[model samples]
Target: MAPMSLQDLVASLPTGETWGPAASEEKTLNGVPYAPFSKGDKLGRMADWTAEGRDKERGGRQQYTRNYRDQIYGAGTQTGFEIQQTEENTFSLVDNTRTTKTRGFGRGGGTVFRGRGQRGAQTQRGGRGTFQRVGGRGGQQGYDSRGGRGGGRGGRRFGWKDYDKPQRNRDASVVAKPDWKLLEEIDFARLMKLNLETSEGEDIDNYGFLYYYDRTFDKQPGAPTSQRKLNIIERAAYNVTTSDDPVIQELAEKDEATIFATDNILSMLMCAPRSVYSWDLVINRQGNKIYIDKRDGSNLDMVTVNENAAEAPMETTESTKDAINSPQALMMEATRINYMFPNQTVVESETSKREMQNPHPFYNPAEESDPPASKSYKYRRFDLSLEKDDEPLHLIVRTELDAVVKNNINGDDQYLTIKALNEFDNKAQGSGGALDWRTKLASQRGAVVATEMKNNSCKLARWTVQSILANADLMKLGFVSRTNPKSPDSHVILGVLGYKPREFAAQMNLNLANGWGIVRTIADICLQKPEGKYVLVKDPNKPVLRLYEVPQSTFEEDGEDMSVARTGDDDDE
Candidate 1:
């Protein structure tokens, strides 16, 4: 057992065997090939650090335990493990080289990898694959289909908080019948582009008398001394429609004008582009004549408050808890104030009143108890003929004047058209951001007027157009406020302000040429049709005008009843 030489120890081993271990017959184990390695290499680890670095550079993770297996055995080497063939094994393949598809769940399930600077990266999971591109700055960013924000510069986005606003659904003033046939549909955009210049209309006849305007109301607003409680005066006032006026009918029979309308109806048509509420006009076409009329109890007779407001007063419903601030109540309150305000602000002395060429046409002293209000009716004629027309188109309108004021510069009488803007409650829901007129009218008059212009654009536009049509020398706007916010019966005149019609129109950016064009456009549509009655209606929810051909007997019943009533009154007189 002494220490032997290295060569003698190796020679003493059994044949086909080495000193370290038994020699194998082949370079394979259990039918699996062996991987070659150098003895100088370091011991293998459970995880390959080099493979981890390479996987990270590729921008993703590899299968779990794949790296460790490759390090220990070799790359692409599978252990010779197999299951015996059976019924379950015959259903699917045992090969791991191919990927197996998986079923997805929940709204196209897949992994969404969102990042920057890694382009052409794909993810496959749950039977779905998504190709993603992580782009850098200055590239087109992506957005979520569910309205999520994408990566980009930040600012206010479009349609932000659109869901928070309330929806407005208004009803039409008149319902359409099945027998009526639609003739034309026109939008406001097309009407705005039209233009027609008209001259100062000619005065055909004058009726009714106007008293002098009481200058006391022109005192400074919000002053304790200037405020006057509105008095309910008894006066005869008439709002005769065009076709119902006897004078207009006489003029029509004489062929004085081919087209006839009252100031109220004509002004509504002229300023139609500014309207928000639905309105309609009745057109009767006789032989070579056209008459623009309004139905009985039309909305044209009611004065609207905040009709053009962004958030107008809501209608009364079971869900609406507030009824005083509703649109119907507000309109009724405004109309009552307008009717009584002018009569209370005029001088009623017989010596001081200005008489027109004719007496009150619609007033009968024997039948009526109250005296007539200070109002004048002037029948004026305007030319709406185009250069290419074969015949001249003339429009005669029955315009009314409220009162007369003496000019300060020349001491001559100036005709005036009076209108009032009312306030119910500034703190109400649909006040349109109006200021308290009692405290702010004197100091911030301009601000109050600007707010009114924004809230009542359509209303004020109609009044101004009416004044211009009447050829009034001055347009007076009275500020009237409710004494109590809860009551509609009691009101007081805060003050009165005057503006020249043309100057006010310029301030409002009102184009007369555009208004004339609207009238002519509507008129031409009727002129081309056969002799019959037509109706022009304004859409409620949309800014459009629809012309329909109605039957000749559409409004004949109401007209006949009105005729019978008038005849009975005349017989009693």
Candidate 2:
């Protein structure tokens, strides 16, 4: 066959043929079925893929006869060389023999192999910069430049261990023995004799006052029981007069003591003022008018309690006579006591419009004092009772103390000072004001309330019975209602008030203990309910406190299933 040159091969190929052999159905130039390019294709139409076919023949097949030796030797040249595997190619053998001779070396010099073996080639690990060498066949060894082994030279594989272990907590269960026995262990009779008093001459103990009453009043022959009741009433008045607790101070300032209990139980009650007074009520019967005094200024006829009672006796209305005679009627007068000063109240409608734009009068306390505790501490008692029970179970009677000493004092200023001290939890710095001065303002307010209570004590006492029976909780707490044969619904609980503790003991009535029990039951329900810890409902905007004393049974029944739900076997895990 003639030698085919590159030009001859190109000229003999089909024009339309692709780089690879055409599809199985494609036609060849000389009647062959499989061709490198399609029949009708033009030259230079092949893509980069066609360039790869240059290494093969026109038919998309390699020249099998053209081996490396044949190509190197070419057609006529003959080179005698046989391809054979050498000993190095057959296997990698372990050589135990090692050379020990040195060739002009100092630090690089060594005593040769420690063991008789050829060391494997040292391989440098990428990025680690550390080298490791295989000993003979399987033996391997490496060392860190910093005299450490393993992970990467001197580096360590750091990790958190036992991070999931539970933490230890301090035990808070240590009971210490007291140096002296508790007060409960001592006979209350002997302890009552201690009669401790502060250096300032104020009684430091509640029992001290009781002790004084017992020694001086009770021991006296034919002393009226009224004398003992007077002492308790005085102590309560004292608390209103001097207590830092706002509730007590408010009662003193307002001259009122709220009776929070019913006739059935007279041992305990949360008492305070019926309403805080912003202005003093001064009735000018001579002028036939009632005047409201803001202390700084006064207004005439703020209310028409009586139109012409002062002008003519026959002109006085029945309502006017009733209002003049009652303390509750006086309390009702408090409703119109405006916080606005005399100047603000006098502002004309046109002037008020301009003032409203500025609003300085409203915001400035000096110009406008806060309305006398608008929702009276009296309102709080009702709210508390209503929240816990469907209706008020007891009467918050407005009462006055008997023969209380009146000392001139500013109730508001004193209350403010007391409040500041309480906020910082501080005691009075020096001698407190004289008891006379301390109690004077409260006494005046208290007297008004007391006079009202005194006139209506009989009627109020009856109302108290109805109130006690109405309260289911008070009834459950052993406050029994006795029915009267004459009045269908009316009843009486004897000795609810005015009975002395000594009288109870001497008569063996045990009434004092029963009274004490009622108090304890109330305290427990208020403080120890399991549903949550005890907390006072406080609204800073409202100065009054709403308090309730729930019965123990009531609180437990509220969460009756709690104890049962908490029961089960302990889990060691």
Candidate 3:
């Protein structure tokens, strides 16, 4: 061959020839498809120096990163080219080094103490101390930075190790026998999302009489002039359950409504999502009617104190040293206060009392020693039917009014529902970070009420719901405090505050439609099943409601047993 210039060599080459291999029509080479890659992709290194020893140090986390990195370079399409290792080709390396057993807590050889102090401290016995951190710096004094004893002054007090606190396993109001079958379990989250619009409901009938509310208690709270010693009033008051009431039974016979409930039980169900304590209601479904009733000496009858608090009053079994602040004791004290408050706060004069449509249905003057308390029971019916329903769903609730007050704007008689909130000891362990009511109740009245709303959310919500259900013009909340923090027997009325029922509901963010939805949903559940006795129980620890299809003799035996006990006690006396 003869030597040629660069231009002559280029001209002598083939027209479509190039310096690289010839372009092929087939997209595969050696039966392997070409892996599509972007022009902006960076070439990966065959061996990564920085990645060495990192996989072992990071417990093989680097392998995940390597796989992810490979995916960025179109490794997904190159799977066919990957080598398949067989059992023969794979070899395992076994270490001959002897492993020594170590004594330690958890993973490391150091004990872990959780709290606000030195994480791993040594005990006096030369062993690691896993004692929970007490409070304050260096765990010196029994104080915590987050409002424990002698710390975080003026700040809200939080329970120590709330997460580690023992679960409050409260006993249900009625025991579920082995024969009772669980029908449904609904969570509060689901209940909260349900909503149904309902009407204000019609007044079916009215019973009992109410006295005029004495306006003297409405003076400024915590004032020496306004404070009055809560007197023990002898009055015959009745809390007849739905099925026990003769009027309700008569209405049920007349087919007035599909559901029957009292204000107390209905309020509890409507505000179930706000409740923290364990409560149960008896659901007796007969033919086409559902009656919501409570047992005698039920917790539902008694008002709860701080039942919705983050750290509610504990039982003696829950390591609560203070018996006066226990849940049972507080409930008794609150119930007593609620029972005596309305009677004493009203002017019980025949001339000033407001008569209802009928006289007291359950009271008999010849059989009772004391007169009837100032109360009025109004039977109201609400429509819970949706647009798609064939038949209208109605609920009749026996609502109550404590007293009748004359409106200031118009002299018309305004119905009132009075409820008292009792205070035990603000400085007690489970006081729910309450302020000193005697001091703050006057100057910081809003703060006191706000704190109460936070602590007693369920109780207050129930009261509000009851007030609304009764169509009361005003809701009176009396603040009653113990004469001695150490003694719950003696209490003095601090003051009384008045709020419109609807306005109060608005303040609490309580939606009547949502409550109606919950009630309707529960009613529909029972209506779907056959005629049987059902028990609706609020879960103690969890925000859940469970419906149990109990036997016919479930609560009947309980009542009989209680009656026998009472008779025996009376005979012994």
Question: Highest TM-score, which number?
Answer: 3
- lDDT (tens digit, per residue) of candidate 1 on 356-412: 999888999999999888899999999998899888889999999999999889999
Full-model lDDT for every candidate:
0.77, 0.22, 0.77
Q: In model 3, which regions exceed 4 Å deviation? A: 1-159, 318-322, 557-573
The order by descending lDDT is 1, 3, 2
Clashes, model 1: 0
- The TM-score obtained by model 1 is 0.71
Q: What is the C-alpha RMSD of each candidate to the true structure, in Å?
A: 18.0, 38.4, 14.9
Off-target runs (Cα >4 Å) in candidate 1 are 1-166, 319-322, 558-573
* Candidate 2 local lDDT, 1-573, one digit each (tens): 989998898889999665776467666667776657564443332234433453463223342223222332233222233223367766553422222344322222232222212212212101011112112222232222222332432222111121252322211111112221211111112211222111111111111000100112213222223121110010111112112234333433453322222211221111101111111111111111111111111111122111111111111135544422122232223112211111111112332121111122112345444421111011112112224444332212211111111123532210000000000001111111111211221335334223323222222222222222222111000001113222212221111122222332333212223322332333334323333211121111121222222222321233442232211101100
Question: Model 1, poorest ten-residue lDDT window?
Answer: 122-131
TM-score head-to-head 1 vs 2, winner = 1
Clashing pairs in 1: none
Clashing pairs in 3: 135-143, 136-143
Weakest lDDT window of 10 consecutive positions for candidate 2? 415-424
- Better by TM-score, candidate 3 or 2: 3
Give per-residue lDDT, candidate 1, residue 502. Answer: 91
Query: Which candidate tops lDDT?
Result: 1
Superposed Cα deviation of residue 506, candidate 1 (Å)? 1.1
